[model samples]
Target: MKIIAISNQKGGVAKTTTCLNLAAYISKKKKVLLIDCDKQANLTKNLGMEGAKTSINDLFLKRKFDVVNVRKNLDLIPSSVDFVGIDLLIQGELARESILKKALDRLESNYDFVFIDCPPDMNLVTVNALTASNYVIIPVQATQFSMDGVNIMIDFIGGIRESINPKLNLLGILVTHFDKRLKISKSIEQDFKDNNWEMALFKTRIRRNTAIENSQHKDYRMTIFEYDNQSKGALDYSNLAKEILKLIKNLN
Candidate 1:
């Protein structure tokens, strides 16, 4: 199975949203597993699985844990708010950086893809996720600050590859909340081109849309495809899924 981590050291960059929708779309034809590695449990809460007895924390703590099937061919290992303090607890463990890899090694080989939703921090949990992943997708907003975070995250991923998983590769930098009408957005897109980031940037940009936000609302809690299949948000993610599949196929 190919494991991909959705990560960005900055919040509001659509890491969780990307993880949720991308996995949902891919799981339509391929078995996908999602691991919520954020302490906020936004992914878990978004899926309405906050009350799950087993969580990603249980896996980190080496406790008995089970995956919950959230949809057809889609399974989730939810996160817990208790994970906020898990870093302190696992810091003293042996081979802490590889704990997540070891946990995943014990799981049954039943997934075509595993998507990990990492927290918006360069902490031990994020390190563990990187070590366990084969590839990473960094989501960024069309802002200078988000571009700064992308640089920091690239350096961080380099460290993880040099020290931990040499096989880990950057899948791409995804542009989210993009608005072509906004000058800042257009500037950022130009900035990416000027810096020769086109090689690493995904061609598909996730446009800013109210439908995308409403789909994630507590009352709705729907995937983009489920909420509005014809929406731009849905179309972008669908194209992204196709792009990713083609990229991975070429890589392999």
Candidate 2:
């Protein structure tokens, strides 16, 4: 299985959104599993699985994960708020950074792809995600602060590669919340063009759409495709999934 971590050390950069949509789109043809490693449990709640009895926290604290299939071809290791204090427990533990990696090793062969939604920080939680991931997809928003976060994330990933997972590869940089009409968004795109991206900078930019946020505010948190397949948000994400699949094939 190809384990991919969708991470960005900045909140509201479409990290969870990208993770959910990509997994949902891919699950149509491939067995996919999503690990919500963020303590906030945004992905879990968004999928309407708010009260998960067993989460990634249990996997960390007990070394056991009870997988839940929210839909066909898609399984999830949900997250809980209890995970917020896990760093305290992880400290002083042997191979603390590899805990998630070890746990995931048990289930890797069951799915064609595994997507990890990491927390918006460079903490032990994210460390575990990176350690378990074979590839990473960074979601960069079209904002100045988001661009700065991208630079910080690069250095942080470099440190992880040197000390932990040397085989971890940066799959690509995905621009999210992009608005062609916005001058700032255009500038950010130009900045990425000028910057020396060591990895692929994806051409499928997720355009800013109200439907994306509306997915969460509904009765049951739904994905863009479920909310409105014809919407720009759904179309962009579908295209993104196709592009990612093509890229993966080429890389292999």
Candidate 3:
């Protein structure tokens, strides 16, 4: 399976939303496993899954991963607040960085893609996600602080590559909540083009749509495509999934 971490150490950048929806969309064509790596359990809540007996916390503590099948072709390893204390618990453990990698190794043949929804912090949990992932998709917003977050994440990913996973690569930078009518959004797009980072800035920009937020608020827990296929958010995410599939094809 191609393990991808949907990461951004910047809150309000749609990280959890992207991770949840992307996995949903990708699962339509491929068997997908979504792992909620954030202590806040936003992704878990987003899916309307509660009372998970075994979560990612168990993987860190006991090296046991019991996945919950939410639907056909889609499974999830939920997260809980207990994950916040894992750093202290695993202190000085041999190969702590690879704990997640080893857990995932057991399910190597079960999924076509594995998506990790990470927290908006550069903590050990995020480190474990990066160490275990083969690629990372950064969700960025059109804000000055978001740019700084992207730079910080780039440096952090580089450090992880240097010491932990040399093969980890950036899948792309996905622009979220993009508003074509807003000059600030346009400016951010222009800056990405001028900077020309080695990784791609995805062509599909997720437009601001109330449908997406409403679905989450209502606990619908479905992708925009499933909630409202005609919505702009659905179109954008569908396009992004196609682009990701193309990239995966090229990489192979």
Candidate 4:
């Protein structure tokens, strides 16, 4: 099984969007687990479940009661606002630093892909997510700070590879909330290319679509085929998924 962390230190970059739809699309054809490592519970809500205080925290801490099951190949470990406590927990208990990796170990054989939606922070929680991840999907908002808060992230990934997960590597960096007409977006996109990080840039950039934002407000994540199914958003993510699967298949 391949475990990927959908993360970035930047918020509002559609990190949640990428995680939700990617999980949904993959589940359409295979067994998938969408882990809500974020405290916001957005991923859990999209799955039509509410946050359970004892949910992800329970699994991360290795509670005996934590168990995973599936309905039609999509299983999720819910998270709630209470998960903010998990950050402190992970820091205080060095023994639990690798808790997420251990929890995933128990469920690996049953899943084809395990997607973790990480909070937009570089803390103990992110450390656990990164350490457990086989791949990292960095979502960048195509606006001004598109590349602003990336250095710390790069440094953290480097440190993790050196000390924790040497096999972990970047899956891609997708540009989100893009407005092609904007000079700012265009400039940053160029900046990204100049830095030689385009290897993961998808040809189908997710443009700023009202439909995509609307789906989030309505608390749903439509597959690229579902979100304006014929719109660029759907098509782009579908193409992105194809690119992702090519790499995932290579792993097996």
Candidate 5:
């Protein structure tokens, strides 16, 4: 099984959305598991797990996590607000930052792709995500500051490499919330390609579209695309899945 974390130090950059969609795509035949590691539980909500119980906190605090099937071949480790204070407990209350790694190790092989939706910070919670994950998929917003925060993520990955997981690889920096017509977006896209990336960055960038927000209201996983494959957002993310599959195949 391949464990991947979808993360960005900056919030509102489509991290949770990407994780959900990616897992849905990978579940065509493979058993995929989506973990809502973020305290906000946006993933849980998007997956229609509102007010759900037996979240990751329950698992961490007492190994009582309940896995629920959100799709035919996909399962979710639902999350709740309790995870917000997890950093404090792991640091000042329990023991260390690596407990998440231990918790996830038990379920790693149960999934073909374990997709973690991470919070928008470099806190201990994120550290455990990095330590447990074998691949890191960064979702970079089209904004100017997105590039600035790349260095911090790189540094953190460096520390993880030196201390925790050397086999961990930078899967790619997925440019999210992209606006094709914006002068800055095109310029930044060029800059992203011209400069050195953390690794082989995916050429497919996710453009900002109301369809993604629309998915939130529809209670589905870009399933709108299945109905209307000609839609731009549909075509874009589907192409992304192809690109990502090629990457994973090479890794295997």
Candidate 6:
């Protein structure tokens, strides 16, 4: 199984959205598992699993945790608000960074892909995610601030690769919340090109769409594909899943 961490130290970059929709799209033909590592538990709440009895917190605490089957081929290990203090709890433990890697070693073999929805910070939890992942996907907005976050994540990943997971690789940088109608969007796209980031950028840009946001509303809580297959958000995620599959195939 290939483990991928959808991470960015910056918030409001659609990291949870990408993890949710991408896993939903790929689970159509492949076994997928999602690990909600964010303390906010947005991914868990969006999936309507907030009341889950067992969560990723249990896994980290070395207590019994359940793998919830949220969709046909998509399962999830939900997050807990308690996870906010997990870093402090695990800090004194031996080999603290490898805790997640060891836990995932037992759970990942059954799935084709495992996507981790990481928190919006470079902390112990994010480090654990990176250490356990085979690849990482950084999702960012077209704003300069988002680009700054991407640069920070790149440097952070370099440290992780050098000292922790030597096999870890960056899959690509995904542009999320993109809108061609905005001049700022065009400018950022140009900036990316000017920086010679074409090789590291994904061709699929997730457009800003209401359907995407509406799908995650409390009243609906549906995947983009399930909420509106014809929407641009669905199409983008579908294309992303295909691109990721092809990329992983070539990498392997």
Instruction: Please provide TM-scores, in order, for all candidate models, with all chains considered together.
Output: 0.97, 0.96, 0.95, 0.90, 0.91, 0.97
Per-residue lDDT over 54-83 for candidate 1, one digit per residue giving the tens place of the 0 to 100 score: 999788897567999999999999998889
Candidate 5's displacement at residue 103, Å, is 2.2
For model 1, name the residue pairs that clash. none
Q: What is the C-alpha lDDT of each candidate?
A: 0.91, 0.88, 0.85, 0.76, 0.79, 0.90
* TM-score, prediction 5: 0.91
Q: Which 10 consecutive residues of model 2 have the lowest summed lDDT?
A: 191-200
The runs of at least 3 residues in candidate 2 whose Cα sits more than 4 Å from the true structure, single-residue gaps closed, are 144-146
User: Per-residue lDDT of 1-252 in model 4, one digit per residue for the tens?
Assistant: 999998898778888888877777778898888888888888777655674445887766655335344346888788877788677766767555578887787776888988889987887888888889999988888875545576567777889999988989887777788898988878876777787866667665777877766666655544455556777677667777887998777866
Candidate 5 displacement at residue 6 in angstroms: 0.7
Question: Global CA lDDT of candidate 3, please?
Answer: 0.85
Model 5 Cα lDDT, one tens digit per residue, 147-217: 66876787788898889888788888888778878877777755655666634567898888777778767
Which ten contiguous residues of candidate 4 have the minimum total lDDT? 62-71
Return the TM-score for candidate 6, rounded to 2 decimals. 0.97
Ranking by TM-score: 1, 6, 2, 3, 5, 4
Checking candidate 3 for backbone clashes, the offending pairs are: none
- Per-candidate clashes come to 0, 0, 0, 1, 0, 0
User: lDDT value for candidate 5?
Assistant: 0.79
In model 6, what lDDT does residue 75 have? Answer: 96
